[model samples]
Target: MGIGARALRQRVRTAESEDWDFSEGRIFGSMCTQPAPAAVAAARRFVTSNLGNPGLAPGTARLEEEVVAVLLDLFHGPAFGAGGWVLSGGTEANITALWMARNASRKREVVLPESAHFSFVKAIDLLGLEPRWVPLDDQGRASLEDARKAIGPRTAAVVAIAGSTELGAVDPIPALAELARAHGVPLHVDAAFGGFVLPWAGPAAASVPFDLAVPGVTSLAVDPHKMGMAPVPAGVLLVRHREMARSIAVASPYLSSPQTTGLLGTRASSAVAATYAALMGLGHRGYASNVRRVLDLTAQLLAGGRALGLRPAVEPTMNIVAFLHRNPVAVQTWMLERGWDVSSVSAPSSLRFVVMPHATRGTVAALLRDLGSALRRFPP
Candidate 1:
């Protein structure tokens, strides 16, 4: 006899209960938050739809288009000629961007920062492209001088990180864009985390230019799942021109669309629905409020760490905070033992924390109390 739905659900819930709950606010090392209620509902409603064969799910496809359009406007892309797709998250989006660049330029070298995500490593390996790494400055931003030296005739694309994973550093994108323009190569900004945060970050982030609006920037990737209060598997890839994506297209003879542009074949429409619902429900003001709350929480974390004799690695540029530590890995292990899930960064040898929306004042206080005890034990 088949198992009943109630029993199956109970078994699943038992398994899931073992995992850390974001609402408890112990997860400080991740970029993702507990998705918005509306987003969750929309995702559930569209769980069976698939955009891979758009003819069968035309409404879902249209929803995906609308999501792309909204993101393009948010990122300040060109009003008319820009195009995008909702793919499987930053890795696929990054790979797709490089694939397009490699096909368009027929070049093997990609200039990028040391702070760039590990996804780029996979991208270059899979695409048969070479990475010309540029060192970062004291502040974790990419060194523009080294980047200039790295670019050459063999360069396919210049990769910049708008929100670095380790230190939350924003690279000198405007300068890099100009350099790429001088070298006649395309610029791809990995704003997977910042794309949703920076726009609403107010005047502090206004001076930074890390999108398609800047000249020489051909493509950009952003994740709605990170800071947009959307569920997982929702990444947006925007290109300055519609034709730029054509380089990576392959014929899908049996599908509703003659060609597919991304790495995935049968993507879930749940992500599309969830992303659209998140964007539409929150809008600018709602997201701005979310950003404000997280940023404030980040500030609190930094101040608390300082009071505990922990030094910040750098003044935080976003909701991410890191503190200099003699043994970050040991600290991470200690925190894990205590039921708090934090991370460590290698480059600066520090403990890392991302103050997502799920994190609250009470949680920050609880984390600080544990951190002080950990510091007394670790002596750094």
Candidate 2:
């Protein structure tokens, strides 16, 4: 009531100006994406709806169910009725799965690779579970041999990355699944980066078994916000059986249903609607096209980096391409000064680039040109 609309609009414009333009396609820090217009429109349409309390918005609940169904099918899982829920992002989805796994296995030990996302550290800290860190293989995938030795009677679950955040290396999931089956433990695949891209990544992607169809993978976390071009705060945690959600579900007497299985209360219905719209609007073919383009850009990025004398840390399995440099910090600084938003990978002392929908071919070529100039100055 106090501030005029004109002033408020000015404030919003000022704030937006401070942030980097995503459409410029220069950011390479995190999995930042330009939300698809269809998804954004859907979010705007459902902005007032609430998904936190299902009883209050049964229609939104149905839409959420549909989103889950689409994701499940994409991940090659069982039918929609099996189990899953849309959450905020990979972190929440990961914690929810860990909570269920801890309860289901009746154990407090979780084993994952060092390459696992920092979200697992939060899970271990929040849940009071002991974490056993396994080493990564030469390719940056979780070591299958070490995983076999890690699982024991107190082991709650083993986590395998579908497409790791740093180098985008897909793990030996089928082998890890076999280990889980042998140990009678749950295996959760963190497909936050790959889930939207891999299924449509052509026949070559079939070499990596990182889907629910694999024998012993019991659950997974996939982010619609990452590669699905959905608005932010849209992630889905899926499990093999519906009963899995039952174990750690809490009873919310105030809500329509007596039990609530999700990790968060008062979720944004807009995100759910947007994710649903993205799946429906793009479909499989649309996503396949997007992945193909991203992969192509990634190839260009790799080639450009190599031509500039930087070596790739790993063979890119997905849309992420990282190259090790003699002085990554200097390169990052140089790129930033030139209006590029790039990040450094600490593990291999490299520069990371995520080729997503926003990274157009022309923009990638421009980036390569700039990168060449930066290398000439920095010499690394």
Candidate 3:
């Protein structure tokens, strides 16, 4: 029905030696089509062998509980009786969160920043709720003032981004939370990019404060694929109140044999197992340190960009760096020639780089070297 497995496998099998990487549905650098390590391999084997969801066995369910607990604890949610569930990706997590928020609300409108992920609009469309655009500040973060203006009683939810897609900006969550609380409305944070990464990379690194620590933040969407560095489909949807999630849970006759639907339907157990393995592979200190690596490298890359007359759209809050250029097309062409996978922003013809965990200082240096040479050849 949806993009089926046999077709996808054939497509991927054909791309085993492609020149560019495919991630988050985009192809840019050479990182895509790379093979998995042994942990991922082992997890895949286990998943295929198991007939059902991770609910099929003690080992799978135990690992699931462990992964959920660790994610819940790290994101500042209550460990006692609180719940965390996995999804296909951030899109699924965000859709579910949006649906849950909409179901909990008495209003019909959802307000989000202009730079909110496209999936939010898609989710809004799917949920049949009206979406209002909240303007962004000069710094590219969501405008607290605009959000305040947008929040009338009819406003069902105020969704703030924890690391926006375009500029890598973060909305002021504490400030946004205050506004949401005053109006007695729930705030959904789409930390799909920033969530797992932010607990390790804090306010000094992030443009805004996030996590369950923000009282008015009703729910959060986090992806373990990005900064969590797990295999795909390792997205998480966590709620501040377990009761709120009850609005979305419905009984199904399909679950009669298993006697449970558990939150989402028959999800892939391999993704859960991969994330569980990844969390253990990169524990608390390790995750924090890996995040720090990307931060430092982004800062490093931006420094080089500056010498070539580029400036941050907003100073990077995390591993993402965005800069404006009069002619991003030309610069992009130059970068592509040098084996870089940066994005050109259409909003203002800017350039943005999402520094992956594997992007080392050596990689940064190589990118800078090519950039410097290109800038000299074509002054923009």
Candidate closest to the true structure, highest TM-score = 1
For all the candidates, what are their Cα RMSDs to the real structure? Answer: 1.2, 1.4, 4.4
- The better-scoring model by TM-score among 2 and 3 is 2
Using TM-score as the yardstick, the better of models 1 and 2 is 1
lDDT of model number 3: 0.74
- The number of the candidate with the highest lDDT is 1
Question: What local lDDT does model 2 show for residue 243?
Answer: 90
Error of 3 at 27 (Å): 8.5
Off by over 4 Å in 1: 1-7
lDDT of each: 0.92, 0.87, 0.74
Candidate 3 residue spans exceeding 4 A from truth: 1-14, 19-39, 49-58, 79-81, 206-208, 256-264, 376-378
Candidate 2 per-residue lDDT over residues 123-185, each given as its tens digit = 999999999889998778898888878889999999999899888888899999999889899
User: TM-scores of all models?
Assistant: 0.98, 0.97, 0.87
| Tens digit per residue, CA lDDT, model 1, 67-148 | 9899888888898899898887999899999999999999999999999899999999999999999999999999999998
What is the lDDT for 189 in model 1?
Answer: 97
